[model samples]
Target: MSPSETPEVVLHDLRAGDGLPLVLVHGFPLDHRMWDEVARFLPDGLAVVAPDAPGFGDALLTESEPSIEGIADAVAEALAARGVERAVVAGMSMGGYVALALAERHPGLVAALGLVDTKSVADAPEARDNRLRIADEAERTGSVAPVRGMREALLGETSRATRPDLVAEVGAWIEEQRPEAVAWAQRAMASRPDRTAVLAAYGGPVSVVVGVEDELTPIEQAEHLVESSHDASEAALVLVPDAGHLAAVEEPEHVAGALARLHARVTR
Candidate 1:
């Protein structure tokens, strides 16, 4: 892809709030709605834009290969469309991959970062193969059931044992995803490069958040993100207790608090 090429994706611009803009990127098989609860807890006077990444939610995948870099470019374009020059980019899970890509590919657009329930490493061989298999199944079946099967791994043990309602809500979101989107996202993630170097080089504030009970991208990954960043002393490492991969959804207040702090640090 050329530097001038950016995929066209839909942007949900919430024109409320006052300070610097906050761009929220959702994970695979989910849409901007994933941040609904977290958005409510954000500090007032901030502009928030949540976009549907290509091949996910309402966004269409126009690229031949939906690579993470391509999605990151799309995010930059979406932000530009909203008249936002630069903003704090926050992402979860697969979205985090795109956020890292944004910092690497479009550094001017990212003032800070909020990486939640995500990691900076590329998928291992076994994990890559597994993602391909899941993608293949989704393409063949035209259904997201295979991806949905990962709910247990995506949620924390505590959420699974106690928050049946939240689990069901998450399931509904997964079920609504288009199978093609699931396949494309799997492929995109499988092909993503290790972006720890991006964090190591970033000069702005970063918030690495994880759920204490998260099994997918565990607490260790969050700690590594903070430790590896070039500005480690400025990065904030937050652990949301009893939450899982969808920490923002499970513990919106805690996630919001982390984001608020990051915003405060950046603006100050």
Candidate 2:
């Protein structure tokens, strides 16, 4: 795909043996490729759908405002277009926000939810300020350098040295992204709503996963989600050792394991 070429929306459907649908959502500044690693071990006989968020990857952003709701709507549209009715939606970071929005906006569409390395609360003032600051930097610097910093921020501190291959894979993916898309996503995520209430209100099987070394969305936030989730009894928390924000990439096997277990729980 060329740098300027923007597809309406990129949807990748990987057919496993086929049972229930597992929809994977990517985080900000990234596309569906982030799930490639973990998708390998997600078990057979389950359909895996990884859609690139609008304004990211092959998915183009034709909309004026790309808020969480907008992204969720676009995803729902894409799923509908592809004949997906009910799915086990799993999201990471920015994708997590979209997942919650999806569950809220179209409850019937989600059979189960997996929130990974993301928070249920809205962006705090300080967090919003940071996103805005990054957006300003992206606007000024054309989004590449700032996004590079974002890559570092998302990965664990030790990943740079211990997991060079993972870092390289994510770095290449970041470099492949369009600058305009990154900036737009930065703005959208900055303005996203608080979804703590969404979690508390939604009565569904939810799986919350976090990385031990994830500084961005710390364990405390995961704990809060565990406490607040409506189906707390069914809410499963998997803390991956030596992993960080991007758990799927940092420890793909572990993330996949958690996802497989969640899938089984919801299906059974």
Candidate 3:
């Protein structure tokens, strides 16, 4: 893709009376497909928009290095391009970072907010360096190996022990991604700044979902979001049992239920 061009997004049934527009942003190493299960249980009237980030899923990597804020801006542009001026914007993990950036940079475009399995703080020094290391390894290998093990690490203990099919499915998704995309995501995440203030400033209703067993971004992270977002008129924090970082995939029904509630808040 060109340096200035934004990745295009697929839209679903935004016709009149289709209800509020919603955009679901995917996390790192995964694509729009990650939300397949959650979308199934969302309120029926939503005009859903799910887009692969710049380099994950079937999208191509750009010549320029991708930034979370840049990706958020691109998503905003993409939505406007699709005749959507505003929508309920939600994301998971890296996508949550992008969602926060979007609200920071283009608050007018976000009618409501949903943050799933994500945090508002920037990576610590060691974590940031590790991400850079992984990015370097991925670029050198020209493969997603550097992040392949995350498929297991991302799951909760219960999932790792009992959900072989889920593990295999996550592994398959990770393998399909290109090394460039992985590197791009790592670079973007490594340099991200704390977004607690963004969440604290947001005026819309908010939803925060995380697996109770999610070690990566734990329940504390979810609570921090709720505590920091006192400005939001409403906030819902959901903990999915027996799931992990990939709660939306590990236990779709629970994740879907959280999103359904967010949709209700948006329309209420």
RMSD to the true structure for each prediction, in A, is 2.1, 3.4, 2.2
TM-score of 3: 0.94
**Which sections of candidate 2 miss by over 4 Å?**
1-8
Q: What does candidate 3's lDDT look like per residue over 70-150, in tens digits?
A: 789888887788778878888999999999999999999988899999999999999999999999999999999999889
lDDT of 2 by residue, 1-268 (tens): 4423322557887556566789989997888888988888878787888989876887766746747787888788888887787888989988899899999998988888899999978887997888778777777877567778666778887796687777877888888887777777777788888899999988878999999989889999988988889977789889988888988888889999988888887788
Model 2 compared with the native: what TM-score?
A: 0.93
lDDT of 3: 0.85
Work out how many backbone clashes candidate 1 has.
5
lDDT of 3 at 154: 86
Per-prediction TM-score: 0.95, 0.93, 0.94
Residue 29's lDDT in candidate 3: 92
How accurate locally, in lDDT, is each candidate?
0.86, 0.83, 0.85
Considering TM-score, which of the candidate structures 2 and 3 is the better prediction for this target?
Answer: 3
**Tens-place lDDT digits, model 1, residues 89-203:** 9999898999999999989888899999999999999999999999999999989988886666778889999988988988999998889888888888999999999999988
The candidate 1 region of ten consecutive residues with least summed lDDT is 1-10
